[model samples]
Target: MTSRTFAAFLQRSLEELKEQGLYNTIEPLEGPNGPTIAIRGRELVNLSSNNYLGLATDERLVEAAVRAARTWGAGSGAVRTINGTLRLHEELEEKLAAFKGTEAAVSFPSGFACNMAAISAVMGPGDAILSDELNHASIIDGIRLTKSTTIRYRHSDMDDLRAKAREARDSGKYEKIMVVTDGVFSMDGDVAKLPDIVDIADAHDLIVYVDDAHGSGVLGGGAGTAKHFGLSDKIDLQIGTLSKAVGVVGGYVAGSRELVDWLKARSRPFLFSTALPPAAVGASIAAIELLQESRELQERLWRNAAYLQQGLRELGFSVGATETPITPCMIGNEETTQLFSRRLYEEGVYAKAIVFPTVPRGTGRVRNMPSAAHTTELLDAALAAYAKVGRELRLIP
Candidate 1:
């Protein structure tokens, strides 16, 4: 395409998004992303962060990062295949494996990269992937990159998944079949039926892959969704991100030692990308150790979620069906969802609205992420704001 053609296409697409109320205006946080954050110098109750256990601002992790920076310097220096894999990286992987209840684990620069690397490493042209319709974007892109046959089933519909899996297996056109899903749907805050998924996998001899980015530090006493259902060993691939609950940046894939070995030997990201910095590696190690040592933070996170959810429900706002701390206020339609989020901001709440392409159209919502760092008093303030804005907009009684 010509430069002028590309420029006009970009401008037209952005304009279309803006007109449709789908273009998001990202709010910059002026301070640490904690229970309350300073946005544009105004402090607001932060309900948009993914710091489930509130470990992002933990002093222990900070100190660990500092010590690591002082001892190991700023970066890992080269790609993992070219001497970038440090003792720090190995230690982090080992700790991650123990935390996830897997035999071995491999790390990547980001959670998104982990999906791409993990999927492509094991799947190819003749293979097929039975994906949940609501799987993350990275997973979809990973499947596309593999040039494999992709079959999408309804979100968490066990019957649909079972039919699709059986059909794919019986087709005999594919060498291998994989059933992949998100342990916790980020937008809906609902968990996948892992028990049902596993049964289907076993019936068809399909490989199971679960991307538990939002579940790793929030479910199963902080062990994750698979363990929440006691199917950790039955799962073939368990993917996670250190950036969210772990309060650092990076991603990982955990499973049998052979799986990890294959990833180390064949995954492109592991071979081509630079390793995580010493600070991130150290902080992640600290985060996992903290999760293993105590359940205090996870408990607080649930309490906060329940409190906020009850408040929303009492105010007649629909919080989605979520077993985890991710509380979403369902306000149908793009315009209202966007307006509601703006009002929430004006009322000193930091909940962000999620709309189409992220979730199905007309099911837009203001997704709230409660954390352990939030106090009752702060949560009360947020609830008050939600009530006020909801009533003013006739979103609730």
Candidate 2:
């Protein structure tokens, strides 16, 4: 297409989104993403950040980063297989494996890359993946990239999962089968039924992969979802992000020594992409140490989540089946959800609206991520704002 036609098409696409109240404009944050953040010169209670333990700005983590950077420089300079394998990288992997109760661990620059690399490296054209319908975008993309036949089980529906697993196992079309799910669904805050999933996996002799991106620092006494369910030894592959509760930038997969060795040898991302920065790896190690040493932060995080979820429900908003810190205030319709988020921000609460593609078209919501750093006063203030906006929009009484 010519420039004029291409421009017209882009304009039409944007206009369509705007008309449906689905256009998302990025707001620049001026400070650290903490309990409170500055956006457009306004301070708001930050409920959109993934810093669950509030360690993104923790002094110890900062010190660790500074020390590592002073000693090792900023970048890794090459992929892990090359010269990027610094001492900090090995230390971080050892720490992660210990924390996850696994024999070994391998780091990736990002969780998405880890999924892509791990999935594509382990499974391919003749293999099959029984994935959760609500699995993260990265998992879906990774599975797609593997050229594997993917069978999407209904979200958290054991019956659907069993049906799909049975069909896939009995089909005789694939050489191997894997079951993939997020330990905690990011949007709904519900915990995955790992025990049931494990049973199913055992019954079918399938490889079990759990992406505990949202559960690591907040569950299993800070060990993660597998530990939370006391099934650490039973889980095959556990993928987690250092960027979430760990408050650092990177991802890791924890498993048996042989599996980790396989990833280190065959994963393209680990082979081709630069390793995580020295600072990030150092800070992540410190974060894991903190989590393993104390349950205080995790306790506070759950307290805050419970308080906010209860308050919202009392105000008559439908907080979905959340068993974790992610609480979604279900306000149907894209326009209404956007208006709700705008009103909350206007009232000094920085909650974002979830619209189509992130969620189903008519199931738009305002997702609240309550963190350990948010004080009661802050939570109360946010609740008041949510109540006000909810009332104004007739979302609640």
Q: Write the per-residue lDDT of candidate 1 for residues 1-397, one digit (tens) a residue.
A: 6699899999999999988889998777788989999978899999999988888899999999999989988999999888898899999999999999999999999999999899999999999999999899999998988999999998899999999888988989999999999999998899999999999999999999999999998999888999999999999999999999999999999999999999999999889898999999999999999999999999888998999999989999888788778898999999899999999999999999999878889999999998999999999999999989988998888
Off by over 4 Å in 2: none
TM-scores, each model vs. reference: 0.98, 0.98
lDDT by residue for model 2 (170-206), tens: 9899999999999999989999999999999999989
Task: Supply candidate 1's per-residue lDDT for 50.
Answer: 93
- The 0-to-1 C-alpha lDDT of every candidate, in the order given, reads 0.93, 0.93
Report how far residue 199 has shifted in candidate 2, in Å. Answer: 0.8
Clashes (candidate 2) = 0
What C-alpha lDDT, on a 0 to 100 scale, does residue 350 get in candidate 2?
Answer: 93
